[model samples]
Target: RKARALLVASLLLHDFHLRFEQVRRAEVLALLRALGVPRVHEDFIFIIINFSCFEISFHPQSWVVTSLVIVI
Candidate 1:
């Protein structure tokens, strides 16, 4: 039951992160456009945002799982 609760919490957090990312992406794009940044630069910024989101979502989980494996 604890595990199930954790799973549910994790799913909720993941969904929140995705929604936050979408809003953040929109805000950043708007800011860039307002500043008259070029299309190529906009694409680069988008890539960076994606990488940041990936790291935010997965890197800590990987570390925790690794530590658990080592402890076991």
Candidate 2:
């Protein structure tokens, strides 16, 4: 259950990081790895490619607010 929760949190953080205007693809992968999101190193390149292909916006403030809400 803990691992599952960590996975979910990692995914959420990944999405949040992606929403940032200045976040680089490499940084995202690094964040995933730092968060221990399983297989990040092996899939880093592909993940970056896929994420970069998508049209997404990063809102840093929203991310912080949402994270605080989640914590509470």
Candidate 3:
């Protein structure tokens, strides 16, 4: 059980990092949209949302800090 838990935690952290990257990219596109830039690809938006949820589920606190730092 302990080993399983550790494995799960590691997977979660890996997923969180991937999602964090996606969200960061999406936010940048969003900023561009706000600035009258052409919209980004739909696939990009979909990937961002999907990865972001994975990150949120895996590590909410880390996601918050990481996302904020990336955004800024």
Candidate 4:
């Protein structure tokens, strides 16, 4: 289940990156660096997706925790 969530997040990250402007792109990279996420790590992509506010769809319905987990 975690693998599936990571996969979806990865794809969403890719799609989001394509729409990012140069200034925002630089800012994201900087934020990642500040957070200690290495550029080469695959998890950085997932982190980007999460930070971008892309909702992850989970099964059993119970996995949905958007209402409780505040991003900021």
Candidate 5:
């Protein structure tokens, strides 16, 4: 449960270092590796990082994903 949340947070976050972390997400990453689910997670992590570096979603050249934590 917490692992999944960490995975979600990883994609939603920009910097790799987190502000409030009580649980190490590495455990979840290990589980994913053991369960063969790391591919999807790694891919998304790469996408998030790529977007963060480029500040744009240019792969498909269609969608422009915004920040997950948006101000209303």
Candidate 6:
């Protein structure tokens, strides 16, 4: 069915988006590890990852985003 095909495509797109985010988070944290930063808690890492994903959409270059990232 056409509807089913659309649903499958939507799901695949969502999965690809999640994978892209995971890649970005992995690269960011890997670079940090390479620079000798201490390992972060899983929850903290999640916050950073989520923030990184949204900051571009919402705040772009806002100081609020920068301050919150620093504070977290």
Q: Candidate 3 on 1-72: residue-level lDDT in tens?
A: 231111112222232344444455556456546645455565655554554522343465334322211111
Q: Cα lDDT for residue 32, model 3? A: 45
Candidate 4, residue 40: lDDT: 30
What lDDT tens digits, residue by residue, belong to model 2 across residues 1-72?
Answer: 232222233233334543344545576556556865555443544553444433333454432212211100
List, residue by residue over 25-59, the lDDT tens digit for candidate 5.
45425534564443444554444443452223333
Model 2, 48: alpha-carbon shift in Å?
Answer: 8.5
Better of 2 and 5 by TM-score: 2
- Each candidate: RMSD: 16.6, 8.8, 13.8, 12.2, 13.0, 16.2
Q: Per-residue CA lDDT of candidate 6, range 1-72, in tens?
A: 231111111112121233323345565456446645566455655666665523322333322222113223
Better of 2 and 5 by lDDT: 2
lDDT of 6 at 13: 19
Candidate 4 has an lDDT of 0.37
Write the residue-wise lDDT of candidate 4 on 1-72 in tens digits. 232222222233322223222324455455456645545344544454456444434545222222111122
The whole-model C-alpha lDDT of candidate 5 against the native structure comes to 0.35
lDDT agreement of model 2 with the native:
0.40
Give the TM-score (vs. native) of candidate 5.
0.24
lDDT of each: 0.35, 0.40, 0.40, 0.37, 0.35, 0.38
Ranking by TM-score: 6, 2, 1, 4, 3, 5
Q: Cα deviation of 17 in candidate 2 (Å)?
A: 7.8
Q: Which portions of model 3 miss their true places by more than 4 Å?
A: 1-32, 36-38, 53-72
Worst 10 residues of 1 by lDDT: 63-72
Cα-based TM-score, every candidate: 0.29, 0.33, 0.27, 0.28, 0.24, 0.36
